[model samples]
Target: MQKFLSNKKLIFELFQFNQNFNFARNIYLNVFNKYQKESSIMKEQIKNFYLLLIILSLIALFLISCDNKNKTGTEGRTLSYYAGNWWGKASGETAEENILTINGDSSITLKIGDEIIIPSTSVTRVSDTNYIASYYNSTVNVSTKFTFNFSSDTQGKLIMEITQGSTSQSSTIDITKK
Candidate 1:
């Protein structure tokens, strides 16, 4: 009877230890599972953030390309560059006052003192900085060519050469944009 009771006591102690161990193990497993779920959520959030950044970057790039495509002609220059009223004086043998009006349609109306230059004047742009204006005089039946050299977008010099039966004369005008 004494040996049997000692054996029963040992069995009871072993069972108590096993129950404590099982309770601790259950707690550890629950904590681990909760931490794993939190980690997975954090990973998903980071991935979503990166994906949104990439999409925004691509949209910005597309907008920039569209803006560039809408721009026109050599720094987006238009006919307005040459459209204005310029006033100056004619230099050389025939010194006189000159007022030149340039239109948007490449037409130029030049006034030298009280007289307007004859034969409807028109301008032709040869390059970015060079232009030629032709003036036809109906009475004289001769065409005078004026060459313009632009020093800047706002100021330039104009030279006109008139030839009539070997009698040729030239004049220069300093022009400024108004």
Candidate 2:
């Protein structure tokens, strides 16, 4: 009878241990499933973030190309654009018909009415759109300076300053490409 009771006690302990193991297994499965779901959600969020970044990068590239297309030739001014004939009338201090010619070699010729006042001479570049041509006549003790400022690809302004002894006179002319 004692042996039979011992056997029954051993069976009861085994059943209790099996129940406890089952409970622990259920808890482990639940935790694992929860973590799996959270990992899947995190992976989806990372994919979405990368997708958004690619979309924004494409939009930025498109905007930059469009901005470049809207720019005109004035933004990309070159020395060759100034090699042409310009005609205008001096209006400020002196009134006369003038023809200004810019050569391919960055030289200039100025004609006032029927006479060539300044011969072809090398011009000094002040900037991308500005130049100066200067002449001095020692016989008459006179100095002349012509300043050219190009505003666009085909339009410009010329200012002539003439100095004789201590007296100075200035004139302005609006010029157009021919």
Candidate 3:
């Protein structure tokens, strides 16, 4: 066994193994350093992507909140053109007892005397120049129709021609903004 172990090849391979080991070690360390740098760069890129997403999300949220606020304000209002107290006299009876109130809920209650002439009812938008209101009246047992043709607005006064079908009374009601 001793004679076999004393081979000349083995004696020469010891120096070869040491050189190969040192060369392999240096190459492996260089590769590891480059890999570490690439991994760090990839990590930074991922962080940047996350940050961009967060910013975009915040911007979207802000716009959505602003839209919601505008909508809520509009929804809370009854009408943009008709809001406030109006007083007008129907045909030949200039007693100054006609009063109409348009509420914020798009409802109108009209009073012509001590009793309520028109109950609170729904009001719908027709167009920029017209608005029609028709209501069921149980007092006289007939459907009463009211039609209005808007002329224009100056300052806060809204001039509209109101026509009541029950008595065929036509009058002008000047609405004021509150």
Candidate 4:
């Protein structure tokens, strides 16, 4: 009877140990599965962030290249832009439809109504779009100075101020490229 009782107690202890081992294994498996799921989500987030960064970098590079190309288009400027025939109305007492010709060699001819005047002139560049044209007319024997303010390569405003024998006249002309 003592041997049987001792065997029964040993069997009960073994059964309890088995139950505890199974419970611990279940807890470990649950914790491990949760950790693995969280780690996978973190990896996906990091990958998405890197992809967005690469896309933004490419867009910035593209915009900078386009800006550089536009800057290169308007690089050099010369006096040749003023070498053309322009038709516009001049201001002041002689305000009428005028045909003006600016030659490549810096000569100027003006046709106001039926009268034509050829003025002796010299042009000096002030900046990329500004110039001073000094004119000496021997027929009227007067000196006139013109400020040529160009707004663009194809259009500009001209202001002409002349003094002749105690009389002063000024004219403003808006001209476009022919």
Candidate 5:
């Protein structure tokens, strides 16, 4: 009976919630319930914020990877113009190094060496800026399709490949300008 006395300060402070109280205990239960619901909603939104950030980050990485296909040149650098030393390595049935030297005369020198034997070294330009150097006595041929790969840059990897329907040999070479 004495505990049922009104709390004047509580009633005044919660004047707006006066009509929204639990009549049995005279508590502003409606206001508390609404506040708790809003807080939980805010927490859920914060959790989704991180999830959205993760999805956006993954999309950005995928775009960057697809944008760059061949990645053997310096950043923001196109292929070199002419005349430089290029090296490359390749792997298929066997692995080997391609040492190439290009001259201003539109000629090229390529050496495929594996220590024990130097199969062959040849230099011949088929057309303008296009050259074909063969080794292994025509057994393995590295067709270098060169045009806009380099201009005057100093560092790069030479792309060399054995001709299709030619043989069962491949090599990839890493090169630097001399």
Candidate 6:
């Protein structure tokens, strides 16, 4: 009878230990599943953040390109638009018919009547629509400055300043592309 009682106590202790181990395993499994769910959610959030960052970066690049286009004045007209023959008449000091020719090579010529006042000279662009050409005539001791401002693709205004010794004269001419 004594031996049987000892065996019964040992069985009870084994049963209790088995139940505690199962409880511990169940707790561990629950915690591991919760951790897996939280880790997946965190990964998705990081992916979405990267996607949003890429989209915003693209928008910023597009805006910068548009701004650069406007700043360079390349929206409506270009330097090639000013390359053509223009005709007009001087309004001050001399009422002479003038022919201003602009070449594709950035060379310009100004003719008063049949005489070439400004021989083919290189033009300097001051702005999107403004240009300048200068000439010094050694025979007449005259220095001439021509400022050309284009109002449109076909029309422009020309201001010519001629300085001889201490005397200076300015003339305004309205020109049209031919």
Using Cα atoms with residue i matched to residue i, what is each candidate's TM-score against the true structure?
0.50, 0.54, 0.50, 0.47, 0.33, 0.68
Instruction: Tell me the lDDT of candidate 1.
Output: 0.75
Poorest lDDT segment (10 consecutive residues) of candidate 1: 113-122
- lDDT tens readout by residue for model 1, 75-174: 5343346777777866543543447876666566677644453232365667777878777677877668888888887788889898776788888888
Report the C-alpha lDDT of model 2 over 129-150, residue by residue, as the tens digit: 9877888878889898989898
Ten-residue stretch with the least lDDT total in model 4: 112-121
Note each model's CA RMSD in angstroms: 6.5, 6.1, 6.4, 8.0, 15.2, 4.5
TM-score preference between candidates 1 and 4, better one = 1
**Candidate 3 least-lDDT 10 residues:** 154-163
The residue ranges of model 3 lying beyond 4 angstroms of the native Cα positions read: 1-14, 23-27, 30-34, 40-44, 47-55, 58-69, 79-85, 89-98, 102-107, 125-131, 136-143, 147-169, 176-178
Q: Model 2 off-target regions past 4 Å? A: 1-20, 23-27, 30-34, 37-41, 44-71, 76-80, 89-98, 112-132, 137-141, 149-157
Looking at candidate 2, the ten consecutive residues that score lowest on lDDT are 113-122
lDDT of each: 0.75, 0.78, 0.58, 0.74, 0.51, 0.78
lDDT (10s digit) by residue, model 6, range 1-178: 8889888988888989999999999999999999999999999999999999999999999998877655555554434558787878755534535477776666666666445544334456677788778888889898888898989888889998999999999988889887
| Candidate 5 Cα errors over 4 Å, as ranges | 1-27, 74-178
Instruction: Work out how many backbone clashes candidate 6 has.
Output: 0
- What would the per-residue lDDT of candidate 4 be over residues 1-178, giving only the tens digit for each residue? 8899998998888988899988999999899988899899989999999999999999999988877653543344445457787666665545435467776765566665444444334667687688777767679788888777888767888888888988889888887776
Q: Tell me how far the alpha carbon of residue 110 in candidate 5 is from the true structure, in angstroms, after superposition.
A: 18
RMSD to the native, candidate 5?
A: 15.2
lDDT ranking of the models: 2, 6, 1, 4, 3, 5
- Model 4: lDDT of residue 94: 53
Model 5: per-residue lDDT, tens digit, 121-152? 34343333333444333444344332223323
Error of 2 at 112 (Å): 4.4
